[model samples]
Target chain A: MGMPLELNTMIVTKGREKRVEENLFVLVKEGYRLYPIDIPIDVKKTMDSDSSGSAVIKKVEWENSSTTITYQLVSLNSTN
Target chain B: MGMPLELNTMIVTKGREKRVEENLFVLVKEGYRLYPIDIPIDVKKTMDSDSSGSAVIKKVEWENSSTTITYQLVSLNSTN
Candidate 1:
């Protein structure tokens, strides 16, 4: 069956450390049932600051089941 | 518009190291354009042997665009 769905993308920075980490851990713990794959960091972009970086995180949540799978594009240099 | 699709899942063991790694790298390099989320591993099962482990990998590819996103659930102990 084809399911109608919406995809959400988030760009997280180093300053959002706590939020990002928390979200990531949650996704890691519960993502498998929703997605058949592992979340990978594909593209990374570094900003001017040493401690801050920008990344694109893709999260796919099933509209019917409410299950979610999250993937992260981490800045290679970002400490978080 | 909703697209008709099929999802493929693979179970990989340590013996298929090279194939698994190659497929993973390809998915990483080309996955973003397909899905909006990162792939995560929620469950891992370890076998009797020390060097081998088993995992489930989910890959989503667009039938028309031919874009693919790959997620890996690696055996935590698998070296490669």
Candidate 2:
């Protein structure tokens, strides 16, 4: 059998992201997933939320069945 | 041009790994990389080092030009 994995084109933070630095954020997710690197992708507070901003992932770490990602916000669609 | 990516069949930790549980470990590496999911692969302290163990990758994540993998040690070839 194979592990369940997902390929994503966006970041749905679900309000669990932590600000690691100015314009940079880190988020941890459950399970194995894939995202495009060095490219811009949409970021939202949730899957159903409106697009909040654009970000470029700078690092991703997976361990203990969790995925941790570091990203930098490139642009914001709205302030609120 | 497309992003640079590597498909890896083994893990060379280089002593940069953190043990999360008894048999589970996490490793993060620079650059986008791919590993087989749910299958056993070689694990070593370095590329030149002998295989330390066999591990089944449970998760692989790519982001920001880095690859993160979570694996479970299945069998060890040595005690050291």
- TM-score list, all predictions: 0.22, 0.67
Per-residue CA lDDT of candidate 2, range B1-80, in tens? Answer: 54677978899999998899999998989888878777898999988989999999876777656777788999999675
Best by lDDT: 2
Per-residue lDDT for A1-80 in model 2, tens only?
Answer: 65567888899999999999999999998887777778899999989889999999887766666778899999999665
The C-alpha stretches of model 1 lying farther than 4 A from their native spots are: A1-80, B11-24, B27-64, B76-80
Q: Model 2 reaches what TM-score against the true structure?
A: 0.67
- Clash count (model 2, backbone only): 2
Where is the poorest 10-residue window by lDDT in model 2 chain A? A58-67
Docking class of 1: incorrect
Task: Give each prediction's DockQ, rounded to 2 decimals.
Answer: 0.03, 0.40
lDDT of 1 by residue, A14-41 (tens): 2323244633522322232323233333
* Native contact fraction per model: 0.00, 0.58
Per-residue lDDT for B1-80 in model 1, tens only?
A: 32333332232232323344642522322232333234333322223444333343354433223334444545455456
